[model samples]
Target chain A: GAGVSQSPRYKVAKRGQDVALRCDPISGHVSLFWYQQALGQGPEFLTYFQNEAQLDKSGLPSDRFFAERPEGSVSTLKIQRTQQEDSAVYLCASRSGAGTDTQYFGPGTRLTVL
Target chain B: TQLLEQSPQFLSIQEGENLTVYCNSSSVFSSLQWYRQEPGEGPVLLVTVVTGGEVKKLKRLTFQFGDARKDSSLHITAAQPGDTGLYLCAGHNAGNNRKLIWGLGTSLAVNP
Candidate 1:
């Protein structure tokens, strides 16, 4: 079975440019999560979605960070006017059932702002 | 606020050695999960412990949840070079089950 995957495994964006990271979760998974991980640090939650509805966006650092899962399958994390602080690895994970269930993670998109 | 603190941020040991990583917090959690991540890859779940004072073993890896549900530990016996990577511990709070509170993580290097 195909696991969760992310597109553009590596992205180098100039400062003030915009970037969109894509994630394709496992088929039929209802819950999806986005996390940001800095170098040598653990992942920090960014947002969460259950099916098509975005349940939590509290972890999003600023208004420039936006995420959408319009069709309830593929999720995108968009950063507008990217800054040096936005450079980090963006990870996506999907779960089979409720919150306590195991979450399968994708390879993640490493975004570097130059 | 919930915070998980992991001790010994970095460890380097020879193959066949044993090591234990610890995660501690002041807040109680509904469950705790341990994950291993290699360079250029997202984390892979190793084990999840739900019950207090529960212990679960995965091959050479052992996971234990504290009796108060506020801490956890991972013990790896006879570590191999393949086990080198970042070990992360995440906790699910009862109030916010969907979001995981993660620790700083421990980076282990096993030399053969």
Candidate 2:
């Protein structure tokens, strides 16, 4: 693809419902990142992947938040029993390599837990 | 935890005016990057400064890195309505880890 692509541009789920968001990064990019952006706030890092390896999950807020990059090209972020606090924009970004490399971002999925 | 503090959470100015936004941190960074984001869209890269005391200009926009590598500033000369957007600064630590520490963005509105 020309740029990173994310699925379900918008999702509205009732509290306690589970939802999954997907991201397709630029072809052959080696680094992937997930972030959570709250209303009127900057995006906060959620997780990072290098190819198929999930090297950093320190930013995941709680056990309810999970992310995986099984094949190294696409990634999924799943939220279990979503809460009102979980309502935010989920952003995915990819970089060609490591160390100060520029990142390309997807449009992001806006999740609204009602 | 590495923290980057950005000033002027919001700014509104008339077209042709000038403005500057600042990002500060106590920790030094190996490199710093600036991004601009519009509503319903992802942030796009503006510039990256690696060396301390480096300055880069992109047409009407100018970016400067602090001599200590702990701060940066984005200045727009004769700002136009097209420059209205959210500006963010991200810093990479001095290590192999490529994770970025981001600053709370500055939202600028240049009204015509």
Candidate 3:
């Protein structure tokens, strides 16, 4: 069985640049989530999707943060005009069902906004 | 607002010692989960507690959900060096089951 995976394990972007982090969830998983983890901090929720529909984006810190899961499979978290404050590890997770289902996480993409 | 707070941001102990990590919240939660993460890796789920005052054990690790579902605790006994990592607690509110409120995490270093 394959676990969740993310591409571009490490990304270095200059301030004002745009970066897109990608995540591939387990096959047939119905739910996906994105979280951001700053230095010495726990992961904070960013957004959530159930299939192709984005259910929650309340956790997104600002308008610059955007995410989408098109066709109900892979997902992308895009940060526009990256700032130094955007430096963090972006984690993606997937679950087979709703509610309290255990989430399987990807290795995560470490983004460094310099 | 729902928030989770974890105490003792860091812990260092020798092998075979016992330690406990706490997670507290002011709001009730429908479910609380514990996760362990190592460097350069994502968190891996350890356990999920849904029932109030419920207790579950895995190996020498024990997990407990508070009687009011507003807190949780994780205890590890006979710790090993391999247990060194960050422990995080996340709670899904009783009202909104999808969103999870996360704790800052407790970094534990178990020396051999």
| Order of the predicted models by lDDT, top scorer first | 1, 3, 2
Alpha-carbon shift of residue A33 in model 2 (angstroms):
0.2
In order, the TM-score of chain B in each prediction is 0.98, 0.98, 0.97
iRMSD computed for candidate 2 = 1.2
lDDT preference between candidates 1 and 2, better one? 1
Off by over 4 Å in 2: none
- Whichever of 2 and 3 has more lDDT, that candidate is 3
Error of 3 at B108 (Å): 0.4
Clash count of each predicted structure:
0, 0, 0
Residues B1-112, candidate 1, lDDT per residue (tens digit)? Answer: 6899998899999999999999999999999999999999999999999999999999999999999999999999999999999999999998777889999999999999
True contacts kept of each: 0.82, 0.57, 0.82
Error of 2 at B10 (Å): 0.5
Clashes of 2: 0
Question: Could you give the CAPRI-style class of model 2?
Answer: medium
Interface RMSD of each: 0.8, 1.2, 0.9
Residue-level lDDT of model 2, residues A1-114, one tens digit each, is: 799999999999999999999999999999999999876567899999999999999999999999999999899999999999999999999999864689999999999999
- Fill in the DockQ of model 2: 0.72
Point out the worst 10-residue segment of candidate 3 chain B by lDDT.
B91-100
> DockQ: which is higher, 1 or 3?
1
